[model samples]
Target: MPTQPKVIFFDVNETLLDLQPVKESVANALNGRKELVPLWFTTLLQYSLVATVGDRYADFGDIGAATLRMVAEKNHITLSQEAAEAALKPIRSLPPHPEVPAALRRLQRAGFRLFTLTNGGSAALQDQIGHAGLEPYFENLLSVESIGKFKPHRDVYNWAADEVGASPKDCLLVAAHGWDVAGAAWAGMQTAFIARPGQALYPLAGPTTYTCEDLSSLADRLVD
Candidate 1:
């Protein structure tokens, strides 16, 4: 394993916050077809990368709404952007995962600097963290909005490291998403993959420094 990093940057959605509530809200909007939530989410991620590659910058929420509309259209359902945004409203107030608070405490007590890095807009990110009462656990919240590019883009990772005044190798990215982990790993940062439900590593990506089932397990391994 790589030595412990000086700064540990976390991916907010799904990694720290439980997305079940948001999923439920989306399910309601999709006429109870809850199975489609994953597809919508994956499409959101895919198009965020598309936006990045196409030199277009849009808020994560906007991309989410657009993807939801696409998903709706594909299924012969109609969804307006405004309505889709309303459905995704739960995202701003998502609760942290059950083990998240305690795991963060453990990591803080172990003297590692913690911060959040996300593709979500800064205003919405602040609301999410504040609503979840996770503000005190992080030193700062970083957003790709400022960079105009999304995760899995090498530039975003590099910019994040520079923004925090840390060498890429001295930073550790903690995320549940395969693409996020891959991006950070390729950018020369250490990575810890939190295997949240339905999450998996990209088979083609290089190995991560650590892989654990949850934040608590990751904390245990980190502080051991």
Candidate 2:
């Protein structure tokens, strides 16, 4: 059997929590538009990449606000600051996917230490984790805010490993986002791809260590 990881770092957002409701909310808020939410999310990610490539950084909240404004303007919807902020509020209260709690419980019971790393602000991440009843499972909740950079950045993954006192080789990163897994792998951590449908794989050079349909499957691999 392969040796088990000493620490497992989970990605927030679509990995553990479902963002569909927030997407739908944004769609409705934009007057029944179906693709506005996706567009906004894509824009948010694009800007983060820009920041990274340009050696600039911005908080997730600021990126979110700017993305929302751009989306609204593109769709010819005039939104005030209050409206933009309100539209993005659902991010903090997104419910965990149905498979999350049980899987996390199983992982905890199996003696695997857990932690989280997200691009979301610390306060927002705390609210979402608390709302999903997942706060108890994590040994630590880490955010890119602390490192002043976003994921796919080597520093964030290095910081997470250091915080948990785990060597990169002994840490496993679990994430729905391919880019995150790619980054972790590049940082010398093992990676498990939570293959949520419709998400694409990152064009990284090395293969991921494992792929699963959801957290439950991932937990089974970790504990078995």
Per residue, candidate 2 scores C-alpha lDDT tens digits across 1-224 of 44578899999999999998888877877887886777888899888878877878888877888888888898799877777778788889898989999999999899889999898989999999999999999988998888778888888899999988889989999999888999999999999889887787777437888889999998888888
Clash tally, candidates in order = 0, 0
TM-score (all chains, Cα) for each model: 0.97, 0.94
- Model 1 per-residue lDDT tens digits across residues 1-224: 67879999999999999999989988888988998999999999999989999999999999999999999989988787888999999999999999999999999999999999999999999999999898998989999998999998999889999998999999999999999999999999999999998999999998999999999999999898
**Residue 204 alpha-carbon offset, candidate 1, angstroms:** 0.9
Runs in model 2 with CA error above 4 Å?
none
Q: Please list the C-alpha lDDT of all candidates, in the order they appear.
A: 0.93, 0.87
Please give the distance, in angstroms, between residue 104's alpha carbon in candidate 2 and its true position after superposition.
Answer: 0.7
Deviation in Å, model 2, residue 12 alpha carbon: 0.7
